[model samples]
Target: MTTLTIRRPDDWHVHFRDGAVLEAVLPHTSKDFGRAIVMPNLVPPVVTTADAEAYRRRILSALPDGHDFRPLMTLYLTETTDADDVEKGFRDGLISAVKLYPAGATTNSQSGVRDVARVYPVLERMAEIGLPLCVHGEVTDPDIDIFDREAVFIERVLAPVRQRFPALRIVMEHVTTKDGVDYVRSQAENTAATITVHHLIINRNAILAGGIRPHYYCLPVAKRESHRLALVEAATSGDARFFLGTDSAPHPTHLKEAACGCAGVFSSINAMACLAEVFEAAGAMDRLEGFTSLNGPAFYRMEPNTAEVTLVRRPEPVAYPATVPFDGGAITVFDPIFPIHWECVPAR
Candidate 1:
């Protein structure tokens, strides 16, 4: 129970912001993950094949030497997106999927699709070409409560999309509610969900228990304790429908602690160690590989990594950096609020 080894894992969701931030944070994810589906929500966004190609190149260049990491690029889905261009990207292997961020849903999503119907042509084309659509999965209606947005999105937006394009593949990213888990299960054949490390470990209390703890804040904001337990059960159940997507977003420490802070948690540095603690605590240690390594590739129609990564538990807690320096500022790392004893390293 103290030692565990599994195939090298892939982060199904991550954000490596451009320039200085990208350079500072890319190493943490690349260190432990064999591949990562890099998010396209950035300034000017990666909305075309050319953009994805350029972004992929930048990610590769930023990667530290000796790490064989692949950045699986995705196009930011906008209402004006070109269907032909999307098909070409998937056909040429430059892009793995298309990201659907409901306009105003999260950071840098102002250019996202506002009217779903306007993008039917693109969605139909993606379905025809077998390309998956990764969604933020929250409705941005001003009247809807933040906690209820994910559930409302399923009823008002996602369900209709699913009913219309039954063949299109979908990944509900960073699912935070039981409603999301149940919906993904209902559409089991062509649908799956990616659970983040922070959502599995913390609830809304992490952000609002006594006073606002801005560092724990994130989009699709963590739900209640009951929802966290649902996420735990689903992840540890060894179901192929649920897998790891850390959503390891980084914001400058000053920005995170400000009056109006950014929404993200940078956990790429200790994600596996935190996951080991979670799985072990749930008494589902044996199924950790499926959640972290095997199932994601199966869902994405890719091969699992042949290499192995080992996590060793020690008597004392492992030390993880509190913040990573970036351009004279720093980005805060997520604190799971619990001690982690496991340390992960690539198997030689």
Candidate 2:
């Protein structure tokens, strides 16, 4: 098969934790991506314009020397989030979007919004100002079955919000099910979804494929194989409504291997490699560029990156780091669906 070359891609969603973990993982993402919208779910969360600006600066500082990677910053929406503040941040270009993580939805997410209606005023303001609301799209209610959260959220929360504020731009982040794909497809405008590399390559089976593989776990956790097929079709369809976002969350290795392992798939190391395999298998390698590089910027009304990057088809197994040594411990990297035999060595 011939190698594929395209404009350098941008990651619509990414979580680069602060300090050393950020330092270790940022390089993998920067190497493959032109830019990435940095998630703001730090311990305290980036709640204000000033916080976002400072966080952006830190990300810039963390970038490997001589790399032009840009970290697009975002604001973490909370009960106390002020609409004026959000608007000011966007106007000043300090932030690109506001993230809504329903409380208890995922890691370091307890600080998330407890009630979506309570944040309606904030969403209204975002809609008025043309800033998109990026959401985790899952119900935190313990009563909701883990596998049904995304579908249920669409019915109980997202659908209602879309009706209430049809003008608001919304990105259903890291969508993991067929329902999510259908939902995003049904809404042609003003709404879109980001498909993660891990979700695209694996399914709920990966988490328990041979046995319980904690590293394969993540929130809105991987769904069934049929759901995975739907994701592949949507992503490779060249539809502007779908785009790339690694959601490459990293946790200390110990945390991931514990009795109650944390939720997040650390895919930064082989994100493009994984995507290449998926697209190639689906015979949609021709559409990889738009999914990886163009759609996200188009949806956000931003410029697609000017730089170009290439992915050649070469056989190389992606090695999993048992742990990425950081401050006091190490962060575990998930074993991708298969040993990624096709490596994506960047052509500068």
Candidate 3:
């Protein structure tokens, strides 16, 4: 089998938590990706231009020596987010997008926007400035069934937002179902979707197949197997509407193994390796470059990465737990959520 060498990929969505966790995980991400859109859901969320700039600097400081990774920063939208600040951040190149999280949607998201309508001014400013809105795309209503949240969000929140701000570009992050795929496909011009490596390879069954697997649990959670196939198809189809976003969220092991486990998967260490397996399984290895590297930059109106990275087809098992020495413990690096026979051997 032949190896594939392509331009360095950009992770359209990722979470590099602050401090030691950030230091430990940043290398895995920087080694493979040239740039990544860093999530804003830090302890208090990056809610201001100054906050984003400071956070970006911290990320740079945390990077291991000699690594040239860029962390594209974002603003966390809140009920009181000022539109002028949003515009200024974008204009000054301090922020690339604004992230909307319906409060309680994921980790450290209690400060997320309580009501989308309340943030219309911020959305309008983003639309006017041509800055895309990256959304978690799940509702926090306790009455909504957990599995149906994304579809409901599409019907209730997404549809109205699309109608209200027709010019606004939206990226539905880490989409989990066929409904999401169809939604983005229908509005391909103004809307795009990001697919995570785990969601593309496994499904809801993996979560319960061999008992409750805490590592498999994530926000928007995994959907049924059929949905998994749809995500795989959409990702490997060479459609610019779908791109790579590891959403490689990491939590301390105790937090994840507790009575109420946290919702996220730490997949940074194995993200590209898992993605390569998925593309190869679908017989679409040739299209992996576009999904992993090209489409995200195209959607964001940024230049594709110029540096090259290579991956070869070799069967080897990459050990989990690359060491999360924070919280006085280590967290397991999430696998593909499936057994993989093929491995990624990075070229020298």
Best by TM-score: 1
Evaluated against the true structure, the overall lDDT of model 1 is 0.95
The TM-scores, one per candidate, come to 0.99, 0.96, 0.96
lDDT of each: 0.95, 0.88, 0.87
Native-to-model Cα distance after best TM-score fit, residue 244 in candidate 3, in Å: 0.3
**What residue pairs are clashing in model 2?**
253-330, 253-331
lDDT of 3: 0.87
Measured by TM-score, how close is model 1 to the native structure? 0.99
Flag regions of model 3 displaced more than 4 Å. 315-323, 337-348
Order of candidates by lDDT, top first?
Answer: 1, 2, 3
lDDT of 1 by residue, 1-348 (tens): 889999999999999999999999999999999999999998999999999999899999999999989999999999899999999999999889999999999999999989999999999999998999999999999999999999999999999999999999999999999999999988856899999999999999989989999999999899999999999999999889999999999999899899899999999999999999999999999999999999999989999999999999989999899999988699999899999999998886
In the predicted model 1, the residue pairs found to clash are none
The alpha-carbon deviation from the true structure for residue 219 of candidate 1, after best TM-score superposition, in angstroms, is 0.3
Which parts of model 1 have CA positions greater than 4 angstroms off? none
Weakest ten-residue segment in model 1 by summed lDDT: 181-190
List model 2 lDDT by residue over 129-183, tens digit each: 8999999999978898999999999999999999999999999999999999999
